[model samples]
Target: MTRLVVVGAGITGLAAAFEWRRRRPDDEIVVVEAGDRIGGKLDRIRLAGTWYDTGPEALLGRVPEAVGLVEALGWGDRLVAPATTQASVVLPEGRFPLPAGTVLGVPASADGLDGVLTPTGVARVRAEVELPPLSLPDGDVAVGGLLRERLGDEVVDRLVEPLLGGVYAGRADELSLAATMPALAAQVRGAGSVLEAAAAARDAGSRSRFDADGPVFVTVDAGIGALPAALVEAARAEVRLRTPAHGLRRTAGGFEVSVGTAAAPEVLTADAVILTAPATKAARLLGEVAPRAVDPLRGIPYASMAVVAIAFPVQDVPAGSGLLVPPVTGRLVKGVTVSSAKWPHLAGGEALLVRSSVGRFGDESQLQRSDEELAADVVADVAELLGLSRPEPLETRVARWGGGLPQYLVGHPERVAAARAAVGEVPGLAVAGAAYEGVGVPACIRDAHRAVDALA
Candidate 1:
């Protein structure tokens, strides 16, 4: 048998193992997870009989691979888009519509931004449109600096950061546009100004049909975890959960991994290995094989965050999809998803669900907060942002993800290139996750296919 070992049981790993096995039925695959369950971050938590996805709640329809994979696994019927465009951006005054002529992070002329911005802010932003776009080599640009130079600090502060916060889970300065969202960076390069690009798109009628095609987000009835579960079921590989790998050494035949348990550690040899763990963890594992690659992998920074799911009476919450809070005055959170209104499937008629995220590169103090402390701060902030007073949550569930979103800092593409180059020296080793590519479910899935193809 062509024994291949796949590490980690997250969505990326699961999809990889499934695709690998389908292509090579003779290969014996072993999937080991440090935790007792397979779905690493993809999980659903139930509070008062209602389920909420603590991990990625939706998959972007922009990427066909995710939809195709779900269809292949017979999960097509489970996919459902939001009924309306309740998604809005939160401003100092109140919640405002995400503007009409904006695509991704770009706006259609500074005039369109007028809906949520002041004339002064718009003028300041317009000045940047005339300035030249970047001339750097093909690599990730610091989205923060790029936006500030091209749009204005206020635009980056009040508009761009929140839009990006939801995706990168970090500060604008800490994220690399090339690594996180190259499409947005490409927009900057192609049109000199985000406004010009969006205007061009609008003229072409390349607008968002949110209600029909899904409001930029899609999910299943059982929860987002269904996708990973389906892959695991399809693969039927040897799954050893709670069995963290402690060490590894390249034996004469292939390689031996130390599977550690409280009782004892067992050695298992495999002909090939697929490392789907986080970059830091993978670096520790591959240090012996590739020293140069391991250092930068270890250097990649990650931000801690918490997902707070608050349950409320249906009438208590707003009548919109979600509210994204810009980082400028982002007191407590990055955004709030009005779950019951956005996706009725996940809500009871009498109750409402509001999901919010707190703590990024700029808010380390909040990242260190205890669950109760964090919940208290969240309650206060929600009240201010959503216009709720004396609103104690009926049911609140909090999940803390430390070192969750990797920070693809400026010059990240170059570093990633160096790491990829050094990786050629380490045979039978490959890495995949949100850590390397754009931080989205689709990006991870895309990397999974790429890694499997490279290995095969």
Candidate 2:
């Protein structure tokens, strides 16, 4: 039987292992993770006497990879759609509904963005079509730069920045348009203007599974953090937790992986190896066998953030699912999700749960504060944003993720392609993770299948 070694047990690595088992059931699969737990960022913690997701709380249901995986594992019945996906953006003036008919805050039409954007800003957006026909270069362009030129600073700051921050925790001016919003980017190239491109993209999205009537995001009743354990069990591979793979080198038969502490190292021989560690760790491991892949991998930067879950002993809270606060507001918390309002499973309890996210790409000073200080600050920010009466939290929990998000800066697509092409040159080597493609669960799963298919 052939042996496959999968380094890193995050969603991508575990998904890779699962895909391999599905294709080659008789093959031996080994998964090695440096962390004490199996799940990387996907994890759950007990807060206010209930299990709550500390990492990503939902999956994009429109994407088949994650939802399909749930179905394949016989957990289809456990899927849950949010009670209300409607969210508001908190501005210095007041809170307003997140404008609809937009792809990641880029308005398809300026109809719904009246209050969200200043009157001047709205006029600028309406004038976009009147501006000279817009065209993208042969290569990628920064998302913020393109929008600011065509629309204005107000649109980018008020609309796009908060949404992109919530997803990547990175600035729009630095993010890649092609990598972040490929659908809109594709339309931008051929469409007459950015507004026309956005309208086309939004229309196309409505025709797909992401239509308004259907659920765009989904989660399990048990919590999204539970997915990693379920995936590990389904794969049924030998998982070596807290076992770091320090070195990887090509061997005559296949490959040899040196893992564990330097003082007590052990080697595992496999016919194939899948490196799913973070970009930096992957770069270090592939230094010898896939030197060309190392630079591109290391070039990818990461952002750190923290999730503070708070339970207040009252049901009366904000009406919407959450509120997105742009950096322009100078709020300590970037966003706040009213857990009890969003998820049906989390409702009907005496306590109202709220999860607040803090920090961005280049800002970690907020994260450096002690857990108590950070949680307190977030709680205060949430109260102000939601117009709550400074309700004391019955219980509070803080979960910090350092270097958790990978930034897809300009030319990210080309960098990833180069890294993958270099790795593919080696017969039995492949790499897959959030750094290579989209950062969401579905993207990671999709890339895992791609890696497995490449090996096949």
The candidate scoring highest on TM-score is: 2
Worst 10 residues of 1 by lDDT: 205-214
- Model 2, span 1-456: residue lDDT tens: 999999999999999998899999999999999989988889898777777999999999886889898888889999999999999998888899998878999998779888998999989989998988986677999999999999999889988999999999999999999999988997998999988999898878777664357489999988888888888888889999889999898989999999988888999999999998889999999889989988999889999999999998765775589999999998999999999999999988878889999989999887999999998888888876777764788899998889999999999999898899889999988999999889999999999999999995
What range of 10 consecutive residues in model 2 has the weakest lDDT sum? 205-214
Error of 1 at 190 (Å): 5.5
- What would the TM-score be for candidate 1 when compared with the true structure? 0.91
TM-scores, all models, native as reference: 0.91, 0.98
RMSD of each: 2.9, 1.3
Backbone clashes (count) for model 2: 0
